[model samples]
Target chain A: MYCRQPLRTIETIDDLHYNLQLAVELEFSTLPTYLQALYSIKEGSNTIAYSVIRSVIMEEMFHLTNAANVLIATGGSPALNSPEFIPIYPTFLPDNEKWFEARLLKLSPQALMLFLAIEMPGDLVPISMITIGKFYENIEKGLKYLDEKMGADLFPCGTLDKQIEHKYYYGGGGIINKVTNLDSALFALNAIIAQGEGAPNKHWDPDKSFPLEDTTGIESGDHQLFMQPRELSHFYRFNELKKGRRYVLGDSHNSGPTGPEININYDDVYNLKPDPQSGDYIHYPELEEMNFNVNVIFSRLLDQLHLAFNGQPKTLETAVCTMFSLKEVIQILMRNPIPDNELGEYAAPTWEYLSPEERTLSSIR
Target chain B: MYRLDDFYDLSATLTDYPVTRLIGTGVGNEYNQTLSQWVRQDVLDELYHCFSQLERNNDGQVCPQALRHQLLSNEKYGPIARNIIKMWYLSIWYKMTDNWSMTYGIPAYSSPVIGVESPTPEDYIISNNAYIQGLVWPLMGSHPMGAKQPGYGTWSDAPLNSIASIHLQ
Candidate 1:
């Protein structure tokens, strides 16, 4: 592997902004990869399995929004539109020390294993670290240190009005606090880490606590829409599936799921070729057409989400509808048989976006 | 609640599965709700009559495996029963064509009952979720392709048991 930039001390406000934008990119990158896998499941057989994976996806979206909220609060525009935001899979994560190549594939043991590793927390003590939770921790430290050194006005980049608050999102899990100062910024950062890694001992207390007053008052009761044990982390959830069981109240991190056997028949899934690019299918026009449609819908989703994030709350409903439509198109692609002498293999969505001009044209139509 | 359970009983009789289990976890009841949303009222009324008649033949009680004989023997109710079975398995309201009906061993009803008016009888999906919940997957020892997913590497193992006996019927 080629060497890259070394981790630097976050001394300047500009450095903090840059790092938070990186955080946004990191959060943004995982959605399509996770969604591609989630969508590739055979319809309706693994209802429980689908739910577990989908909960992760929803939380990931909340993470993306949370990062954007923090960035906007700190007076930086989140650079989500960059092509670099889209990951080149089997590639290095943002500032990871160990070479963990994140691959985009269908929901298989391998994909779930990768997901577990990605959410794995760093060294418990907050020294030099490599995990995503640490990366955000460093950003949190920078936000406070810079706030002291550069003054409280360091985060005047955006206003509360600009933040994508709780109103825009539908899921009742996770708080979207507007980060105007260091405390709120740290709150946002801690929330990210808590959800990603879990509590200090990895015992997720379901009834722990929630921010009581939702500014918009839309969210109520349970912080999560569905009830899951509070102590389960992303890593643990994936591990439970990897081990073919469900976790119980008294189970430790290393223990197997003591509850019910999560009897998942991984067979009969669409044998989608992993990490396919638009260029890979050019030889077959039919596959190419399917790829184009997938990209068009994907691009439309991003466009609508962009609007939704940029102070137009009504666009969120439209974005959700677009997401459901994307599922339909992706399913059609997954159902189509792949050409050649391959058994059980099926055509899959490439998850590419349409060209900018085409996106514009399609949006107009 | 009563009518819905009666419908489930009718569905269970036709599909040869336990009505209690079907009500608890099966898609039959859910599919029936969706069917009512778009299915023509008159056709549903006719189906209710047919189902009541079938139940009447069994002491006005829905019995386990009660209609299996009629599903095989009777001409008037056989095609209708087959369509309900198809809807449960495939989430498709397959209209009975005269030739296709006969070929499938479903003797056509003397008074033809046209289902919900569609431009054509080309099979259509019930709902996206309904399609995923279709009975065909488990009957074939497979999961639906794009909805509910199992864990990774789980597919590498062979299915522990086959419901091929149930499928064969």
Candidate 2:
């Protein structure tokens, strides 16, 4: 199918590597936007709303690691520090249609709707092989093609030692798989696809709901019936929040959430600046300090991830702690309101980490 | 059907605040079941028999003065009644043994460590749900951290009416 579509001419292993870097950047970009929106919700209200968004954000982190692991497995350096790699928001998701703009948003009806679209399973907007699902499908094909031609020397440029093992991640959705071979790589790719966008490899009917795992705790006596219903997909989970309810037993593909009403207090949310940039905080010294601390923690998180992928599993503890500590810093930023802003917005983390050179330059300035 | 309420009145002689108020915290059903389990069936039967033995006044109207005197002042039933109230308030089950003078007993009641103040508990460990549902939350005017979260900005406002009112709204 990828050969049938007009692709970006993947003639060599380097081309595959380039696309993997693009995948990494795409996965890395969503984390900031999701976290900013999650932190905007008031401390106690919207318990279900908080859990649903958090579940997605953790999976996005998992997806980032998966993409990097695949690149390392294929003997390619996973470049995370490139300047252009940090996405400019209101931009399209990696290979999404040009019309769908992914922006930093508060936890509003609008934000929930956008989350639904961003994670909408299946090729909702299929434009030649550009859907994220299709892009990964093409990567799977590229892996097979390289292996067939080069045999034992397919991934000669990279080493297995660079792969981030499953032990680094602390409790989330799927396991962090090492993609050393085609089967393992395909498993990792399928998790990214089915867990976010539905799988294309399974020969299930296109019109029918995608075959996902049944994570919904539905009570059932019939073993076959219980086994059949897939867990509500990520798209469906956000949709449940949008509908202001939960999915209960017997709710199916055609059915909506029939569970008890979830009381959501939207009026009490923090007013965060939409698509906030690192450049925007320069004028306010306090806000600038907040942004700096956020960046420092994030940089340390990346450094920890780098070390964990390189071989040391013990550093993952620091990575987990840094991930949680980022939330505390972002929470503080949420409390400090931005001045002279008519829109009634507050400070938020910009998700931009400065390198040592950039940090020295800022200090000098 | 023999309702547990027939055998014991948590509201009548136990809690100062209405027992129903604690029930409104949303952990009521499980809390009640756990408390019932903690107070064994034989103890409840003894409580029912003791309450029945309390003599009514000559006018056939039960005197509140006499009822308190009959229940709390008795030798055998006094501590058991007190422990029931403590179990509801603190969610900790005190052992029902009358052998406070005994030097030692079962392994469950094994001696405390050198620095520790008390011996190990023989009463079953209370469920975490019961601990969260303990009468203390209403006294503090807050729910447990992870369970039954009161809505956003609720802290700034007065506590829920459920804390004060006896009747279910």
iRMSD, all candidates? 14.8, 16.7
* TM-score, model 2 to reference: 0.61
Task: Point to the candidate with the largest TM-score.
Answer: 1
| Model 2 spans with C-alpha error above 4 angstroms | A1-9, A127-129, A155-158, A199-230, A249-254, A310-314, A360-365, B1-169
**Per-residue error (Å), model 2, residue A153:** 2.2
**What C-alpha lDDT values do all the predictions have?**
0.64, 0.64
Give the TM-score (vs. native) of candidate 1: 0.65
lDDT tens digits by residue: candidate 2, A307-364: 7655554566666756755775677677666768888887777776567665543652
lDDT of 1 at A271: 69
Residue A198 miss distance in model 1 (angstroms): 1.0
lDDT of 2 by residue, B34-125 (tens): 43544445555676677766676796544566667877675555655676567566776676553431322233344445686656456653
lDDT of 1 at A139: 83
